[model samples]
Target: MTTMIKTVDVTTALSDVDRFCDIPNARISGEIFHRQDIYEQELEKVFARCWLFVAHESQFKKAGDYIATTMGEDDVIVVRQKDGSHRAFINACPHRGNKVCFSESGNARGFICNYHGWSFDIAGNLIGQHESGIYENSHFDASKWGLREVALIDSYKGLLFANFDADAPSLKEYLGPMAWYFDALFDNQEGGTEFVGGCIRSTMDCNWKIAAENFVGDILHAGWTHDSAARAMLGGAVAKVSDFDESYSVNWHGHGYEFAMDTVGNVAVLGESALNKYLHTIKPSVAERLGDFRSNMIGSVSSATIFPNFSFLPGQNTIRVWQPRGPNKIELYTWVLVNKSAPEEIKEKWRKGAMMTFSPTGVFEMDDGENWEYCTKTARGKVTAKQDLYVGLGQESLLQETDLPANVYSGQLNEANSRAFYQFWSDLLKAPSWNDVPNRNVGRVEAGAAAERCSLKEAK
Candidate 1:
């Protein structure tokens, strides 16, 4: 008989999540941050079904370079192949439960498990086992026990993503309209981007979603959260974000990206006069390579979360993954991405800038961590868990019909992106299987149709 653990009914809890995150009433139930059972369910349903960031291709400079990371709660090894493709494997020795790859990242010939002298190749094939004579009469099959490969792995530009559910849609399809904005950051230059610095990881007592949300469309927090840094740095033009109120986007998937339309917007946040100067110097080339809209975004400040937990600051060039530990903890891995062909000095400047703005001890990062930690703690009480938290800013009338790939809103200060994120979050939880999830194609079609109508009405 299957064990049916009970307390807060699982079905009822999921239904509540769906009911709360809907449009016209986009609210978040605090229990989402507090419930242990819900967190366990998310490990299987949400993480397993989603396309999650594993590693970047630039990290695989050589044939054997590999990074050991996580896909949701499961540890994974992302390795570069000799033929220029990538593979991800569950990081466990099939013989016993010991992790095969010990190091975070390095070029490896193969992995040898310390627990039982089991050896595996670069592609995760179990090649050797110690004391062959001891298992002569016992039934053990080496061929049947390679490190179990992750179901699917793919890359867009240089960012690698993996999904455990074989039936889930392709990474591009799952990304939906978010790809348009991603290209603005990734493919808008003459040469592509690469991860520059080594990883900076630190733990925080906050849910992964909290950090993801802050990055997505929480521009409202900037002038307040990083107020001191902005005042102290006072890099002339960078200080102008005090008046920012401009553009933001909401992807069909649960992704959120917000940016000020001001040309010097992003670099100003770093209090780095160098980035502002460099951006203006490269605008002509950026325009020629990526065309108008993307070129326009070149010097503008931007932040985005590629739903679930992968995020990046386009201006500052910081890319981070919020690796979930449990209901109230996460291990954050961050790296700085710069144009592969950028000057060494320019790249070095970005490294120092990222360190100042987002590294573990960085000012802005510390401020955001404090808020997320308290948000998680607040939900521990029964009364607070049931209270509906309002997140519906500009929900009913914010989205505007635009030429942009994703549905966009008119202002930088909006919560529509957060709403879309939570809506998709709810959909994934209630979806019985990948096939059962709501058809996003229909939503996109309807959204386009609505945009066209709005455009025609405005013309009249």
Candidate 2:
């Protein structure tokens, strides 16, 4: 059952979205990350309209295993059903504003509200209550008061996603050619990928988009921000500093991926472990399944963001969600995704490696959070908010001349993906309804073609 979501009116925020992101000029105002008005509009335009990743299917190994997570500002519950299928619902209790499930995640047959004894079954059905309840009217039907279900829920491979809008496109449609890249990372494993560790939650003083955009194509910072960690690990003063090649891709609907041209630099963990051996072992099988293009990415170090907030490091085996808390803060949820058939030692190595590099206590993670915090904090100044940040690193160069699903750039350090990301954000805000979202699914091709023409003109 779909219930209407209550949202704050955002008339001014809609107008500001277009003003903040001027793609042709290569400018995005500082206010987009600092202002409360734009944040409110984002919840309506971006979060509500887009299909957001919720929980991985591997998280629920048995019936009734559920993960309580956040979709946007709203709380959500994703539960494995009696059958193998999965369903997601708003975690809010329908009777009152009280929570039905207090824990973040666990196995549960049913959820009983602590404030009142009103209970709901695993399928979100109103099962019991009324022995001592106030709404005990004999004629009133309690069965009709089930928990509010999300309008749409679907899976791509093993990843589950949910959308609030009933009119939004299907998951496969929204994913588009981005699915091709996903298969390279996810479908390559023999037994497939599964979350092998617990979650690590932390909050940082930064806009959600800042972190999301960084993973897309901001590899330039690795050498600078993670200089110390790189020296300690790779014995090099610079992080991921490669003499070989690297590439960036901007898939439709703002999804992105970047990987080094060489695979060794991406997965330079300890000397030679089972993970390294596993990488070599899977290449032939992956090549047969996905052909030469995708199999190249089997064990390569790559960073990607699935549109809005979901991100994963394929080499590191870390997956994360940058959950938006407000204009200036985000609650980050991280988990380890490892090969299903891997041995216990290999899985443990991946888990511990993620903790050392990407978790809250991670050395590299600490460096990144510091940069993002200051990036957001500095924009709080009135004059700073008026400034236009430059995001035009390879703006004149065309990255679309490719047979792959995503538009590929020559260099990994380019900001082409960031440009596509902000444009997608602004377009979603400018659209009055999902029907009016012209810049999304169908427009990316035309946009790429236009970029190609502009590049040719510049060369002439």
TM-score of every candidate: 0.90, 0.91
What is the C-alpha lDDT profile of model 1 across 243-322, one tens digit per residue? Answer: 66556655567888877666666666676678788877877777666555566676576789897899998878889999
Question: How does each model score on lDDT?
Answer: 0.77, 0.77
For candidate 2, the TM-score is 0.91
Clashing pairs in model 2, backbone N/Cα/C closer than 3 A: none
- Worst 10-residue lDDT window, candidate 1: 1-10
> Model 2: per-residue lDDT, tens digit, 42-146?
898888768898988888889999999988998888899999788887888887868888788999998888766777888888777747454675565766787
